[model samples]
Target chain A: MIKVQQPEPYDPLSQVPLVPPPGHYSASKLERVLRKGLFAVTAELNPPDSADPRDVLKAAEPLVEVADAINATDASGANCHMSSMAICSLLSRAGQGSVFQISCRDRNRIAIQGDVLGVAALGVGNVLCLSGDGVGVGDQPGAKAVFDFDAISLLRTLKTMRNEGVFLSGRKLTTPPNIFLGAAANPCIQPLEWRAERLAKKVTAGADFIQTNYIFDVDVFEKFMETLRKEGLHKKVFILAGVGPLASAKAARWMRTNVPGIHIPDRVVDRLEKADNPGEEGKKLCIELVRQMRQIEGVAGVHIMAYRREHMVNEIIEASGVLADRQ
Target chain B: MYAVRLFCTRHARAFESVYKGLEKVFLSLHPLLKGIGYNRLERPVAMIEQMSKGFLFDCKMCGQCVLSSAGMSCPMNCPKNIRNGPCGGVRDGGFCEVRPEMRCVWVEAWNGAKTMQNGLERIRVVQPPVNRELKGSSSWLRIIREKGAMKEASKRQLDPAKSELAQAFAKARKLEPAAVPLAKEPVAALAEQAVKEQTSVHSTQETTSQ
Candidate 1:
């Protein structure tokens, strides 16, 4: 009988300290942003179709001073919105810390490379690469998708541009951008054990930070953190729990009925329904959730996503006592 | 007499299979040639061996790893590895550099990753540069294909019939005879038949019976 010898598991981390090829840029900005730990806060600002960046800029301003950076949504919710890069540029010009959301849905490698270069030129240092929402969910039903590269590929491309100082085509860049790279996660939706594995993959793929989907239950977030700690990934990367103000009763109901990935608990629903004013009640509930999440060890920070109720961001942050030390 | 030695350092399995198949046919036709008369055949065999080794080095550009990780096709074999390129000559889906059956590595990788569970979401995260170190090390091929003498053993036997027979024998050895109750086996068979009959009757009643 022949004895089978099991090979060692492939450890990507074992190749740490492998320097990128000469002439490529380093993702220093991403490293710096994660290390600074100045209680980073970012808000989502969707772009408008028209070249006019009025609404986005206005939406971004109030939170600009308080937030370390503002995250502009790229055709958020699968709608035919304006380019996130353009809006991010406008926000950066307005002196707001801008994090540009680059989705893989609209562009191929050429466009992604070009856009990354363009954004860096504009001095927008933060970038989040997302495999954009499916075209089916967008207003433009028949719009074609041009997924030339996935998120990991985009990350690899960016890493190449930064470290190798060249695009995927091997063309050298004149001036590489100092960009902070981030990715998203949904801990509540997936099986508890798999979340850490997925997060580890993202980290291996070079994601500096993770912005999670809206977190309604702190217990689930705690479980996620426990899993990360158990897997020894808790200390490796920064994770910002997503919290959003539920807005009106209709909005709460809409989120429950419409949002596919988000999990809004029945307890939250019952609280919203029982309150005389659903908006205020929802806001209060969100504040408590954030406060509980903030207390969890290994939590880097919280990203308060107020959905359309952007104004309540200040309230949620204040109520959570996150602003207590800063003020 | 000049002696020629043929060596296949890589992809030894497939190459050995072809060599053994040809050897079998040759021996069948000329049994007397096996003794020492085939020393002259070594030169042509060595040339064929070299050609096969060179051919194995040509990248197939399957992009399995690329698709699983990046959502982009592999550009390892493509001259440009253009994320969005036809180069004006990519006909149907195959690149001009490779076979028609092989689609553009990048396109196929993107499609495969997109279909995997949570693959689309993971695709959103930015990827690091392709470790061209993957090229320098012969490790990728080494990891996929069996190596050394084991690979030679695998190639020598093209069919799995003997292995199948051994597996069947092992299974038969593990099997234990069970005492069956007189009514149990017949009753179970009757129940199965009854269910099948019921299903047929239900299907017939639902259809027009034409």
Candidate 2:
């Protein structure tokens, strides 16, 4: 019998250092923000549909100081907006803190490591690695999806790059990115316990922090936090629970039904439906969620995904009192 | 899609436990089976299973069946053949990189992970690259052998009883079985040959009811 060997496990992060080394690179500002014991607030910058850089600034204008740092989304919802790196480069230069998001859907490891260095050079302090929403969910469902590394594996690879000061090829880097690694979680996704266990895995993979999907269902989000706390992962990583405003009852219902990993309880929808001004009521509900999420023990901060409603983000953040605890 | 129901998924926790139980049962039989002569039926049965599954699910026979984990479609059907997730090359409207006409399998997997109760947890586990060793062989026997090896390794090495059993297995693996004659070509050609052989065999399997 010809004994054919089983394929060796193809771990991209194998042979890399298991733990981070001290003084490897400069630390990111968001890391300081979370470590300070002050509640941190992060908001996403909805890139303008046009190439105008001013549009990016204008979108970011309302979020300045109001948010500790703004996440520049990378082709979120599998739709093209201005590139997250481009906007983040501009934002970082403008002296506003930007958390650059790197989606594995777009690049291989070589390009991803290059982009990580590029963003660090641009003064972007933090990066959120995401296994982005499928292309079918976007305007162009015909695009090829390139998920080179899912969220967890990307975190591991990036951590190796920063700590080891070497590429995946074993070649040394003159300078590693002085950056904080982040990953995404969706607490409301089905098989609720799996979500928390995956969070523990990301933590094991060397994720310094996490930002979750929208928190319409804080009950579920709380349960997810409870699981993390039980696993002792809450101490190992910072979790910024996701919160977003609903434009109306219709928008809430649409998001609940169409979006993956988003759960909107019927009571919230009915509350929006019964309100005289559902738009304002939606913001109120979102504000309430932030307040509620802040009270959760493991939640270190909040990530506000306002979508197209970036202008109202400041009000939501202030009303939620996420920054009120800040020094 | 129908193949998915008949094989994996749709069973949830029931499927995982049954799969583990099958491995345990197979491992327990290894010592007894080592004494018997090589059975010719095993190879033919495995070949038929592979061919039928390949035909039905467009199976790459990744040897690791993620069909239930990835809806009914084969993730290997993706042009890039990424096991863990999708790439950005997925065209707008869920098009594939290599074949633009079809939906990307990983994209379908993401959608499935969200909707399917049985498949939801499988999405988070990172799958390894394709095992070439499993390509031409029966995954059933391979799974059994792999489980037996794992069981042996996990046992305390100081146990003299286990050492004797280990020696027996090593001896059994070293022994020569009667040789079967076939073309010494590559796997692709052998697979093609098997298909032809199967077709001829089935051709005579016509209706006797009439």
Candidate 3:
């Protein structure tokens, strides 16, 4: 079994870097597991809407043990919450590794580049670059959408800082951030033939790995993987298939209608409706997806996004048994 | 206007050829434009450009126009103003998540690119962020100036043994001794080179590890 370590003592003001083992891009355990050719699992932490540090700790306590790394989202859905940097700071202070997500919808290049150095100093090793949801989808519709950089440009900028030791403006840095860069993809979206090409663009822009939007249709997802294989992208980066548990058929239907990129097949919702207890059935479906994803040729792991259902992640991972063979 | 914009993308090749012809006209008129003073003509030229391109492509005049590279569809019209490519939130049926009534700009760009001579390849370029300072300016004039500068540089390179006045003027301006070749390189070629460099870096790391 993979061993869980106790939190080490840390000073919040320190800017010292965590030294990775030789040949690794980061000190992240997720990178270590993936590099060692073992199935890795990552989970998203629902940022609490409160200022209390205890709330952040409570939400992350369960995930720290099960997830290879915890992801702190940056104002996902354009709804304001505890800032992702604060959540990652709390996790890092507690000696836990976290993925610091940066969305380009709210910050310009200057603000974002500064935050990268801040997170890196605080011991964050993985960074997820996203274009973020448009501000119109949020509680506040009047906010400005400052997409100074899209996901591809964001990835490219971060990669330049890490490797070339310079910012986008060619300014030299005293010490560059050591990061494992990642980008988001939606494989089940429209104009299906062009999805893989878009992913290829992201890869060329400096994405070391990819986490897709929620996948409820294995058939369509398999087709996406086939395209990646044909382009030989699978050899260049790790691909993590995103899966989530539904609360009920009504909730699934609502998501399919309201959420921007989510695609829930009609049969899956019908099966959830036919079940005696839809909540329990949703967990079963998620576990089944994990098993099936593990068998896919190019899939490196599964990213579970159990929003508001964080408690079920432990049970879902245990039941899926992806880490059963690890020691 | 929307239908007309769609028509322009459908006939992107025709528009491209038209732009090439217009570029030649602008090039030939450079001496006259300089004589008239570009600063004095800026407002009138900008007004004319806005009147025409606005009617045709609903152009926002971001001033660094990439209409030819983007399949003749204006990227500034995207709700997010994403210049690189489509955001992940494009809805089913290829509609905009933010503006469901309208189709995704990148999707139209892709379709328009398919009919062009090199549209598919050109569309793959990762565009840099828009320069907010260039808003409401005339991209046509800017393109003409850039092309004129390129031509002047090439002429100087070929006839280095020819003009002392032009050479002295270039020295006074503190320009680079030679213009960067990147100004004339295809963006897609640079993107491919970046991918190759990344793969070579990975292979070198593997060799050292072994």
Q: Write the per-residue lDDT of candidate 2 for residues A1-327, one digit (tens) a residue.
A: 111112122222333211123532334556776786667778888887898999998999878757777899998877789999898878865767778998776777668879988887766778998867667767898988776556765776677677777664546689787788888887775545345756765776668889988877777777778888888888888889888889988998887655545667888899999999998998898888888888899888889899878888888877766675553
List, for all models, the DockQ compared with the true complex. Answer: 0.05, 0.06, 0.25
Model 2 has an lDDT value of 0.65
Model 3: fnat (fraction of native contacts): 0.54
| Predicted candidate 3 versus true structure: per-residue lDDT over B1-210, tens digit per residue | 788888899899888889778988987997788688666766788789888999999898776688876788888888888876778888878888899989888888888888887777767765656645456666776666556656676543233322221222222112211111112222222234454676799999999999
Displacement of residue B8 (Cα, Å) in model 3 is: 1.6
Off by over 4 Å in 3: A1-15, B24-37, B150-210
Candidate 2 regions off by >4 Å? A1-26, B1-6, B9-210
Which has the greatest TM-score? Answer: 3
The DockQ leader among the candidates is 3
lDDT of 1 by residue, B140-185 (tens): 2211221221223444423232232222122211210000001111
Error of 3 at A101 (Å): 1.2
* TM-score head-to-head 1 vs 3, winner: 3
TM-score of each: 0.59, 0.67, 0.86
Model 3's alpha-carbon lDDT is 0.80
Residue A19, candidate 1: how far off, in angstroms? 21
